[model samples]
Target chain A: MKSLQEQIAGLDDVLSARLGGTAVSLQPIPGSVPVIQVVIGGREELPIFITASETQVLCICYLWSDEEVRADKRAELLETLLALNPSIPLSAFGRIDKRFVLFGALASDARVEDVAQDVIALSDNALDALEALSAYLV
Target chain B: MSVIGKILTLVRGSAREIGESVVDANATRIYEQEIVDARNAIMKAKSELTGVMAKEMQSAREIERLRKEMIRLENLAVEALDKGEDALAEEVAGKVAACEAELEEQSRAHANYALQVGKLKELIKAAEGKVREHEREVAMARTTESVYRATRSISDNIGATGSKLVSARESLERIKRRHEDLADRMAAAEALDKETSTRGLEQRLAEAGIGGDAERRRATMERIRARQAAAHKDA
Candidate 1:
């Protein structure tokens, strides 16, 4: 599995490129979870979640901007990043075999343990699922 | 009334799946009971049929005995007539005819009882068939109820989570906006105070009439005013 630092770096690059003129930042949460911040149209910084393990990786994006347009932009950035890299399998990172759950939401708890088991299990990552979210940005 | 009801209407349908789940559950139970009742009825009917069959067999045996008695009486009548006893012969003949008629009636009664027993057996078999049919229906209903319940639960959870997330985000944004507004007001107030102070300083300098002139000219003007005032005092 990619280390939290490496994944954050990759995310920073991907988000920065996809959203020009937007400053993006990534920090590792206390427990090796990577938290991403993307400046939406230079207006608001949106936070997203990415979890990686040996066998699975999950990503969830939350809308942080209060303005509708900035929210839209943040959503677009999320969609683009997900489309470009998709969710990388933790097994591909070597030696990580546990399930990784990624949930994107700023107001709601991003903590996986608090969420319902079925919801986490339903979370899936694919290039296509990311692309499919693009239409929802507006 | 519940979120689940609204969601069910949207996805499954208003009239169909919503009520169908409960209906199906109840139907499943009812059919289950129906199957049990049907089996019981069939069992009772079978028992009744068995009893009727046994009674009919007994009646048939009685009819057979009567038939043999009639045959023996006819034989005695013929023997009596051959011996040339007219009165005795007449009496024997009458007894033989009466016995034959009675046996015939008994045979008819046996046939009727056998028919009734056969019909009862058919009814019992039909009831058993119905029990099997009811069992199949109950199974189907149970499967449908389980599927519906699962679907409803999933939808309810999704709706609950989605609304909760949205509400949390709205509240956070509200708090952040309030903070920003307070900060903006404070910045604007500080700027206004600075502007007011700068304007007061400009008014003071203008009243001294030393505002916006060449530095040397203002100093010279001040020196002349001071000397003229001193000379007037000496005079």
Candidate 2:
């Protein structure tokens, strides 16, 4: 049972060698449940926060909030998200409170390389999601 | 509701494993209560299975005891017949008959209990799988709640130059900017590559008076000028 911190550290090393880009920065979000934010280089705008529970290791990227949604198109935006869920291979459309997000989850014991790959896919998917669904935004 | 339907169906559908915010607190509470009820049901079934198994064991013991008593009575009857006591032998035979009947009843009861145990065990196995599936949903809800709190904290100020609160629109703009920047760099490098190609290098060398064609032309023009100057002076 590897900790989420160890997973992220392993992922950082893999991404560093594979990408040859700037190093990924891991910041801890001050919360009770131990969450860490991973900002990938060249895709820093879409920072991903990863956390763990007893059952799963979860990652999320906030696409937009309720306030950013067009006032008349809330339902439409949600419907689109539901429809778009299948298109993004590794990520899912969801919400954390009023803030809509693109997220991925793996078993608590998933491999570090798998998590790293998911992060990259998730980051790219999030950017594409925002662009594709910007019509619903204010 | 279908798994891919409206937001109202998100928590109750198959898509729950992927996670979505539980917008209705009341609904979520009822769902949690249902999980508790199912858990209780599983516990009840497990205890009932234990009781059935115990009964099966008891039936086996009774069958064994009755068989032993019947065997003893048959031995007595044989002894009575050998001594020519017909009435005593007949009485012993009656006792053996009674034990046989009792053994048959116990054997039947044991079989039924064994069947019930098998069924209950299977039921419990299936129920456990379902409960685990629902528990995963509850786990997802808790995780989503945690994410909500954490993201709420991070959403302090939007677009504060390296801040976490950057909006999606601004983030997209930044992504595009980085893409454009990379494109510009690539174009610049390609242009530099072309400028240093074999043709461009040869042209550069000609301008510097060290190449074949340009040196020959310059020398030829200089000789022509010298010849004209000499012919004019001679004339």
Candidate 3:
């Protein structure tokens, strides 16, 4: 069995091969999930945090949130986010650290390619959802 | 007929003739016109599709701008709150709220436009496919019409040639009948001439009493034989 770092490195290799010119680097943070920063399309770096336990490696991309969501629009935003969650594959909208985030996770036995693809999908869906829910979020 | 009636009759006659001529000469032109109409329709649809996509893009851009503004206003509100400026934080919060509401509406519009663009693109694609199919059908129809025309012409020519052959055969039969009739008449004339010549010789022979000559000669020979036999007996 490979370590979490090795699995992430494999995922990085696959992503680099699939997405030409995409730069993938691993940044280990003390006492927290290790972050994989991916630069795609020569744009801003998308940071993906990964946590590995005994059985599963979870991948997450922290999207925007409305911590100060107005009382009137909170229900509407929650509904919108809920509606969008099921539509985006391998991703969901949930509150994390006082902020709503769009995130996805995969099993430890999952292929690196699947993990990389899911990470890309999760990021894309997060950005898209943020754009979609921008008016509902503060 | 009155002058007005005559004019109306002439007009109707001319119109009918013109209609017939037009129909005869404009088959291919009509097909071309249909294709042109379909192409125009496709172009219009394509233009509409492009407009829908442009609207979708615009809405998406608006939503993206509003999202960025919301993020900025939220950060500003957070900073104001940290600095103990409650009024400023409230103002920034109000701005964030406004931006969020606008962003939500724009995002909804963007999603709707995206759906519209998708449907329009599919429609345009289907129309293009139909146009191509119709074009192929028109080409096949033209080829088939040409082949049909050639076959009709060949059939007409064969019919004409068949009639000519029938007439020729009839003429040959008439000539053959005439030849047979002439040969029969010549034979009859020759027989009549021979009988006319032989008729005088037979009449002369009858007139010279040659018909009784053989019987009379036989009787005279018999009488001489009997007299000779009697004389031998006397001797």
TM-score of chain B taken alone, every candidate: 0.53, 0.57, 0.52
Task: Please tell me how candidate 3 rates in CAPRI terms.
Answer: incorrect
- State the lDDT of candidate 1 residue by residue for B1-235, as single tens digits: 4434533343444423442443445656777788888888888888888888888988888888887887887788788889987788799888878887888887888898889988988888888888776665554344334333433332244475573333223434554576588789999999999999998987787777757644567889999999999999999
For model 2, name the residue pairs that clash.
none
Best by DockQ: 2
Task: In angstroms, give how far residue A9 of model 1 lies from its true place.
Answer: 46
Candidate 1 lDDT by residue in tens digits, A53-104: 3322334433322232235466565455455443543201100111111342
Q: What's the true lDDT of residue B166 in model 2?
A: 67
How many backbone clashes does every candidate have? 11, 0, 3
TM-score of every candidate relative to the true structure: 0.37, 0.70, 0.35
For model 2, the stretches where C-alpha displacement exceeds 4 angstroms are A1-3, A20-22, A71-74, B1-58, B61-85, B97-141, B156-164, B198-200, B203-235
Candidate 3 structure quality by residue, lDDT tens digits, B1-235 = 5434433343344433422232233654765677787788789878988898889888988888888888998999999999999999999999999998898899888989888888877877877776775565455443223322322332244365473212222333443466578789999999999998887777676577665555577689999999999999999
Specify the poorest-scoring 10-residue window by lDDT in model 3 chain B. Answer: B163-172
Q: Candidates' interface RMSDs, in order?
A: 14.6, 3.7, 45.0
* Candidate 2, residue B146: how far the Cα is off, in Å: 1.6
lDDT scores in order: 0.51, 0.78, 0.62
Tens digit of lDDT per residue, candidate 3, span A80-104? 8778777788888765434455667
- Provide the RMSD of all predictions against the true structure, rounded to 1 decimal: 23.3, 6.2, 44.3
True contacts kept of each: 0.00, 0.48, 0.00
Model 1 RMSD in Å is 23.3
Error of 3 at B114 (Å): 0.6
